[model samples]
Target: MTVLQWTATLVGLSFALYIGIAIWSRARSTSEFYVAGKGVHPLANGMATAADWMSAASFISMAGIISFLGYDGSVYLMGWTGGYVLLALLLAPYLRKFGAFTVPDFVGERYYSQTARVVAVICAIFVSFTYVAGQMRGVGIVFSRFLEIDIALGVVIGMGIVFFYAVLGGMKGITYTQVAQYCVLIFAYTVPAIFLSMLITGIPIPQIGLGAAEQETGTFLLDRLNGLHEELGFAAYTDGTKSMLDVLAITAALMVGTAGLPHVIIRFYTVPRVRDARISVGWALVFIALLYTAAPAVAVFARTNLLNTVTDAPYAEMPDWFTKWEATGLISFEDHNGDGLIQYVGADAVDGTGQPVRNELTIDRDIMVLANPEIARLPNWVVGLVAAGGLAAALSTAAGLLLVLSAAISHDLLKRNWRPDISEKGELIAARVSAGVAVIVAGYLGINPPGFVAEVVAFAFGLAAASFFPVIILGIFSKRLNREGAIAGMLSGITLTAAYIVYFKFVNPAANVAENWWFGISPEGIGALGMTVNFAVAGIVSRFTPVPAGKEGRDPAEVRELVERIRVPRGSGEAHEVSG
Candidate 1:
């Protein structure tokens, strides 16, 4: 079968499976919608969590970033992975024990203030929308290429599919669906890596193939790639370009941001017990390791394959895959010197005859992973499978983020704050309605995103780190943390971070470089500074303010007791219900 045929067949089957699962596990109550009735098995929950946590940024864009950025991209690898461990060890179980439906719920109850809940709800919505924009863009990219539709139309179609399962089944549906998505995405990701590894290095394992010598030249792959890069006036593949301070700040922001994500934290609430949450986190780490370890290998393989095939090639002799991607407007060529040959070079590059030539080709980084198999002349079925995998990675995270948005609006804003007398059934209807609206908004963002998939996602993580991380951590560990302090911290942190990102990314794009960055921190790393400001502001405010009550009209000692209980895990079947 051709690539299109294979893609349609595989994508159709996957969509059917997802729709069926949603129908089978549709939520009937608010509990089911919000937390799947808190009955998910640890193993299944682990798979679902992995699927939720590894967004399109991981499956589709991380390798692409690494392929182009080289050693500077390691920050993403370290930050995202390390952040998961931080979440698992420090936050997941405790949050599960708290028994809140959303992060806002936890904040409102823990801090005993409706205003705090409202602030948290706003933060969750802001962060979620920013993150979901990337997922929707991922969907559009896959459909635009494989289905040969316009990106805007593809986003609309993806929005429709997500709306069906997310609105009808809620967390109950999304959880089981994510388990199947995990299977599809992981298989799709690894099979192509294995094929390309053997094709390039005569080794079946991609991880080993990364360092193994090439079959034809008997030179190590990394060494060959370095030579190619330097020959083309690009930095050596193994060399780092980012400063140490920027790297550290970006890594720290991503790490803390991961621990504070509302979507990932909500997954722990779906499991049966705190013990199950901990165990599920363990299983999730193992599942996550599979793709994380192979990413650098895949990056190396794709980069090597791309450079070998395209550099200095004639435009008339380009492959079918190149033309197909070119039609999507992702890859373009211009005859700057009227030579009719592609000069895919870096800054200030000189030709073979020592003549300075401009780069004549522009390729989008997000296409590298999706186009890797095709570029390597792999089977049609492999390309199709990757298309499906990218969709799975994207859709799974979109559903999770949409749910967070819905819960924040319906549960946090309306039911808890505005209309306390609202019925459970009414709340369920509200959740679905809000989620539907969110899907449409998300589609709009996808069609008109501010940046590429990974870059937009990095901004979302920065927002989460600056706004949510400090508040969540202090809420859990500090008994003196009052609602005023939490609200102030969230507001100040998110404001500073968002302002910095906007100023550099939008207001002054020319000065986005390192020289103009405040204290050598780029917009991506400014979240760390914002987080520090949050901690300082919250600590100072709490020190000056009077000690607040744990609950309305309750004694102050109970606040200390509340923090103590969150720190310790009770036995199975113990009192797990936290009073709201």
Candidate 2:
């Protein structure tokens, strides 16, 4: 079989395995639908969380970004991984002890108001949909490239597979399916890095290979890469272009957003106890760091290889992968000065012939990981494995996000707020049906991607940092925060962040430069500002509002009891069943 056929077979088998697992593990109760009956082992839950957290952006686009952006990409490395630290220490144990099924459930019960629940649900839905759009788009990209199909048809195939498993098994199916995906993706990601590292730096471990000496030049791998970058008119790989303040802002926003994201937080609900949640976070990070740490090394290898092989080579000497990717428009070339030799520059420049040469090569960052196997000249099976890995990353994340979308619509909106009398069975049906609808909507977004996968996902993080992170933290750590204060803070934070992003992205994109940015922070990183706004607004408004009581109104005795319950970790057992 051809390379494309091999990729199709492997990916097909992987999807079939997930669907079979879903069929065998159908959710029977509302609790099962949402949290898999709260019986998942900590280690297993950690694997599932890794799959949930590392989406298409992580698996496919992140290395490409690092390859191009150089040191600026450290923001993602620190921001995404650091959030798990906050999640473990700040939120996970407490939420697990609270025994809530969803982030909205925690908000509603903590504030003792349906209004808080409604607000939480909206934020959760918005953040999840924004994130899911990237996953769906990721699926299409993998299918288009590997399976050799139309992008729209690729989305349809992805949606059909996801809809079957997601609608059938809910969280129960998703949790188990994620475990399978984690294995496939991580293996796919690391093998290429290991092979390339050995070839370039003579080290098998990627992290160490980065700092090791280059086999050819005897200089450090990093030093060699920087030399190549400067020679080619690109930024040094270790030095960054963005201001430190913007870097700090973007990193903070991503960390908080990672902790606050509902799909990720909800993974803790599946584990059996509060202690399990804490341990699970450690394991999840361990699994995630495996990829996160290696990605930069992969970037280094890919960058070094491209510069060595492509630059200054004759057009006829270019590899087959270049031609294939060029056909997709992910890569393009034009000998602007009509020189037969390729000239790649980060800026407009003259070639060796002193001809004013416009850069011939245009490489999209999204294709970096997808094209890595080819760049390394690996075997056909390895190339096919990378395709399976990309699908795994996209599908795993999409299932987790769609679960929250459907559950919030059915449980939070229909059952809790609108029709309190609805039966649990009816609620489950609603969850499944809503999941189906979400699949189609997500597929449409995939066919017409809004932006780069990671860029769009970053917007979701900004909103989460603005809306959910502060309120949830305050609700746990502070007694003075009232329902009115939380509502106001969420509205203020989300509204301001949304306005900033919409203005730069849609309203007046030309004004997106540093001078035009408010305080020189980019829209991607503005969530840090919005998060601060949330904290400040909550603190200011909380003092004026009457202290909220317990469920009916916080009596002093009930307030103390409420604090003591979540504070003490003794009673966190199986979560009681409710509508999913």
Supply every candidate's count of residue pairs whose N, Cα or C atoms clash at under 3 angstroms. Answer: 0, 4
List lDDT for all candidates, in order: 0.92, 0.87
Q: What is the lDDT of residue 30 in candidate 2?
A: 89
lDDT of 2 at 485: 86
Candidate RMSDs in order: 1.3, 2.1
lDDT (Cα, tens digit) per residue for candidate 1, span 1-580: 9999999999999999999999999999999999999999999999999999899999999999999999999899999999999998889888887788999988887777788889999999999999999999999999999999999999999999999999999999999999999999999999999999999999999889998999989999999999999989899999998999999999999999999899999999998888899899999999999999999999999999999998879999999999999999999999898888888999958866888979889999999999999999999999999999999999999999999999999999999888889999999999999999999999999999988898999899999999889888888889888877888899999999999999999998998999999889889888888899999998888888878854552344765677788878777543256564
Best by lDDT: 1
State every prediction's TM-score relative to the real structure: 0.98, 0.96
Candidate 1 deviates by what RMSD?
Answer: 1.3
Query: What lDDT score is found at residue 286 in candidate 1?
Result: 91
